[model samples]
Target: MTTVYAAASMSLDGYVSGPAEAGFDQLFDWYGNGDVEVTTADPALTMRLREPSAQVFRQLLQETGALVVGRKTFDLTDGWGGRHPIGCPVVVLTHQVPEGWPRPDAPFTFVTDGIEPAVATARQLAGDRLVGVSGGSIARQCLDAELLDEIRIDLVPVLLGGGTPFFDHLRTAPVVLDGPSPVIEGDRVTHLRYRVRR
Candidate 1:
């Protein structure tokens, strides 16, 4: 079986976005370690924060065989405008395609149905490399369906108090958890890699 990796930079308090999904840009900038420090929370989780290094990120991107994301995450990414990263197959999960929505001419496709179908399709497209689960709910659903293989969390050092969470209303009874190897980038962020407990 191929690996399914999730790369994220969540707050210290466990929030993925700020109120109304406002801080996501700042968060990604932090993820890319772009020209911003984005969050201002306690640096206690420094050891778990993921640092930005295009080489490192691209190395992981090279490992990405396909992309999976929820409607919300897909919309947000589309709003950012430009090209999708990874340059692999992108499977977007949505109930209905948005009106006037401009799908990327690249290999991106929308899945209005469910995950298993998407997974099977992505698997066929993935070949030998791994597939990546991009959105929070997508990750949650994958975990719920026992489809995810590994989770690489970029635990940034910030506490936005509340926003979107990585794992919401999730029951951890099925899967197991493993290794939190550290991938420290700067003095600020650290990337923690975990193997799904199965």
Candidate 2:
């Protein structure tokens, strides 16, 4: 079965990014704060994570087959240099395909219709593996559409006062979630998984 999950490394105050795209160093410090090394699909970007975080990251990479992200995230990463670190196909939800995209040899798909179609496309690409929805807006849309199965939070201990939240402006408030089961404690972060209760 393919699970639709939204994952992010969020601050204790519930922000994925700080104001004006600042505070990334505080938000993503855990990615390189340890000695355990984990290489991604991109040869140039390798992560040095704590042992526990390394295991969690490896499992995520193995399980996730495709991703659905908002255009802002796509643009912010500069298309991840044409290859996302996850080494999987990416579906970009946007009003228009960005300029100079749809390049050959790039495992990127632009979905202009909406979040549902974008996720459907990702599921097709994912087969029986997991479909990961990224970016706050996209994740919120998935949640509102009842398409998300789980939420994975790499909870970092920091408060960014204000910024982009991991979850916000839900069409349906008070959405219940199951346990933060299999909680893994890592250096400066805690990996928590919550199943969306139907």
Candidate 3:
């Protein structure tokens, strides 16, 4: 079955990004800086800690056929460098499409209607692969609508007192998380996976 999931590297305080912070690059430094530390002298244990997490990320980027993002996120990041890092079709939700935005034939699809329509378009484009919900507001909409299946949160140790939160303005009755299984844990960060019970 096709799944819709949201994945992001977040701070311990639950913010994805903040005005004080530079950008996502600073928040998600663990990916490039080898900030993930395994506490074993054995090379096998170290590889064990790293390999599965790497595989999961590899699969996420390759298997996700479509993505969804919020308008503010789009504008803030400049459409993710004109092409999403996931290398898939991206559905951007906004009230009005930007004037100089890329055409429909481009990698991005600006959806003005609503989140439902944007998700539907992404689902159709995804086919058998997964539909990835990105950006805090966009993901929150999916979660509020009970449309998200899974959530992968990479918890960075930094504390940003104020910023763009990972979960805010949600109107759902106490959603229970299934498993906060440690996908990856280290000195700098920890990646946890949870199933959203419908």
Number of backbone collisions per candidate:
6, 0, 0
Between which residue pairs do clashes occur in model 2?
A: none
Which regions of candidate 1 are displaced past 4 Å?
Answer: 29-52, 79-82, 99-104
Best prediction by TM-score: 2
- lDDT per residue (tens digit) for residues 143-167 in model 1: 8888888888767677777888887
Candidate 1 backbone collisions, by pair: 49-189, 49-190, 49-191, 50-190, 50-191, 176-197
Instruction: Using TM-score, rank the candidates from best to worst.
Output: 2, 3, 1
Q: Which one wins by TM-score: 1 or 3?
A: 3
Local accuracy of candidate 2 as per-residue lDDT tens digits, 93-143? 999999999999899999999888899999999999999999999999999
Where does candidate 2 stray beyond 4 Å? none
User: Which lDDT value does model 1 have at 148?
Assistant: 84
